[model samples]
Target: MNKTPLNHWHREHGAKMIDFGGWEMPVSYEGILAEHHGVRQACGLFDICHMGEIEIKGAGAWEMIQSLTSNDVRRLADGQAQYSLLMNSDGYAIDDILVYRRSADHVLLCVNAANTEKDLAHLLAHARPDAQIIDLSADTALLALQGPASVDVLRRLGVELNSVPRFHTLDIAVAGVPVLFSRTGYTGEAGCELFFPAAHAVKVWELLLAAGADAHCRPIGLAARDTLRLEMGYVLYGHELSESITPLEAGLEWVIRWDAGDFLGKSHLQAQKQAGLGRQVVGLKLLEKGIPREGMNVVAADQPVGRVLSGTLSPMLQQGIATALIDRAVLSGASEFFVDIRGKMKKAQIIKPPFIQRG
Candidate 1:
C-alpha cells in the first residue's frame, strides 16, 4: 500500500487510518460526526495529496485536451478551472476530472487517486506525439481548506480572498513555499486547494492549522469527507459513476458541452441525448427511519424498479438520503417508492438533488 508524506503526522495526531484506493489514509480524527459539523460550521483541513495531478504542455496541447475531455476546453481562460470527464468511446465515463487552464499551451488535470494511472495511460494513448504529458503526483502535495470560514482564514494568511474568483487559481507563496492556490473544493463550501512541493507538506499543513486555530479550524478525515460530498449530491467515482455509466445517466449534463465540438464520446453522447434517456439519476429521501445502502433494491408497488447507487444518513439533513439510478419510466410515473432495507420495505420520496443546499 502507498502512503502520503503526512502519514506519520496523521498517526501522531491519532487519526484512525484505513486503506483507501491502495493508500493508507486517515478516515477520522476526533470522530466522523464532529468533523462533519466542523467543516460545515467553522472550518476543516484535509490531506488530499493522494489525488493525482498530471501536466500537459507543449504545442498542440490544446487539441490533445479537446479530444480527450468532454467539457469545452476553449471556454477556459488562463487561471480558470472546469469540472469535466475523461470519457470512453461508448460515452461512459472513465473518470470524472478537473481541468485547470494554466496557459494556452499548458493544462493540468486532477484525477481520482485510484484512476491516476488509468487516466494517464488513456491520455497518452490518445495524445499526439508532440504533446508533453507529465505526472506530478509523486512530487506534489495537496491540501483542502474548507468551510464558511475558509475565506476569513485565508485572509489571515495575508491573501486577498476577494481577488480569487470561484474556479479561479492564484500563483502565490505561503510561508516561503511556492504554491498553486485554487478556489475549489469537494465539499459544497467556500474553500481553496493548496498545491505545493511534497517536501514542505508537513510545514504547510501545520501553518494553516495554526493560522486558523482561533477560527476553530481542525483536521478532517475521509469519513466526514464522504458524508459531506454525499449531502451535496456530488458523485463519487466508483459509486455514483463507473465504466458502465455515462455522465448523462449520472445527472451530470452540466459538464457535457456538445457544442464544444467532437470528442472521444461525442457521437454516442449525441445519440443518447437525441433518443432521450432510458435511465435517470435522482435523489431519494427516506420517509421513514432506515439508512439506505448501496446495491439495495428500490421497489415500487412490491416490484423492484432500480438499485441504489450511493446512500448515507446526511449529517446536515439528519435524514436518510440517497442517489439512485432508476428506470426513467418509474421516475416519471411513481411519485414515491420503497427502499428494500434488509428485506423490509421502507417508504421514500423522489426529490431533486442537492439534499443539503446551503443557500
Candidate 2:
C-alpha cells in the first residue's frame, strides 16, 4: 500500500488508519462525530497529500485543456481555479477535477488520487506536441485547513488571506516554506488548500496544528471528510460520479460550457440534453429512525426507483442524509420515497442539498 508523507505522524498520533484506494489513510483521529462537529463549530486540518496534481505547460496548453474538459478553460484568468470534469467520448465523467490556471500557457489540474494515472494517460494519449503534460503528484504535498475559524488560524500563521478570493490561488511562504496556497477546500467552509514540496509536508503540518491550536483546530481524517462533503452534496468519484454516469444525469450540467467550442463528449452530451434526462441525482433526508447506506434501493409506490449513492447520519442534522440517483420523472411529482435499509423500508423526503447550510 502507498503511504503519504504524514502517515508516520498519523500512526504516532493514534489515528485509525485504513486502506483508501490503495493508500493508507487515516479514517479518524479522536472520532468521526467529534471531528465533524469540530470543523463545523471551529476549525480542522487535513493531510490531503494523497490527491494528485498534473501540470500542463507551454504553447496551446489552454487550448488542449479546453478541448478535453467540460468547463470553459478560456474563461479562467491566471491564479484562478474552476471545478470541471474530464469526460469520455460517451459524455460520462472520467473524473471531476479542479482546473487551476497558473498562466496563459500553463495550467495545473488537481485530480482525485485514485484516478491520477488514468487522468494522466488520458491527457498523454491526446497530447499536442507543443503542449507538455507532466505528472507532478509525486513531488507535491497538499494540506487543507477548514471551517469557520480557519481564517483566524491563517492570520496567526502570518498568512493574511483577506484579499485572496475563493477559488483563487496565491503563491505565498508559510513557516519559511514556499507554497501554492489556494482559497479552496472540499469541506464547505472558508478555508485554504496548500500545495508545497513533499519534503516540507511534516513542517507545514506541524506548523498549521501549532498555529491553529487557539482556534481549536484538530487533525481530521477520511471519515469526517466524507461526512462533511456529503453534507455539502459534493460528488465523490466512485459514488455520485462514475464513468457510467453522465454529468447531465448527475445535475452537473452547470459546469458544461454549451457556448464554448467543441470538447470531448460535447456531441454526446448535446444529444443527451435533447433527449431529456431519464434520471437525476437528488438529496434525501430520512423521516424515520434509520441510517441509509450505499447500494440500498430507493422505492416509490413500493417499486424500486433508484439506489443510494452516498448516505450518512449527518452530525449537524442528527438524521440520515443521502444523495441518490433516481428516475427524473419520480422527482418531478413525488415528495417522498423509501430507502430499503436491511429488509425494512425507511421513509425519506426529497430535499435540495447543502443539507446543513453554513453562514
Superposing all C-alpha atoms, what RMSD in Å does each candidate have to the true structure? 1.0, 0.9
Q: Model 1 segments beyond 4 Å from truth?
A: none
Task: Pick out the ten consecutive residues of candidate 1 with the lowest summed lDDT.
Answer: 327-336
Q: Judge candidate 2 against the unseen true structure and give its global Cα lDDT, from 0 to 1.
A: 0.93
lDDT of candidate 1 vs native? 0.91
Candidate 2 clash figure, as a count: 0
TM-score (C-alpha, index-matched) for candidate 2: 0.99
Per-residue accuracy of model 1 over 68-169 as CA lDDT, tens digit each: 888999999999999999987888889999999999999899899999999999988887877899999999999999998887889988887668898999
**Alpha-carbon error at 83 in model 1, in Å?**
0.6
Q: Would you estimate the TM-scores of all the predictions?
A: 0.98, 0.99
What digit string (tens of lDDT, one per residue) describes model 2 on residues 68-161? 9999988889999999998778888899999999999999999999999999999999999889998999899999999989989999867666
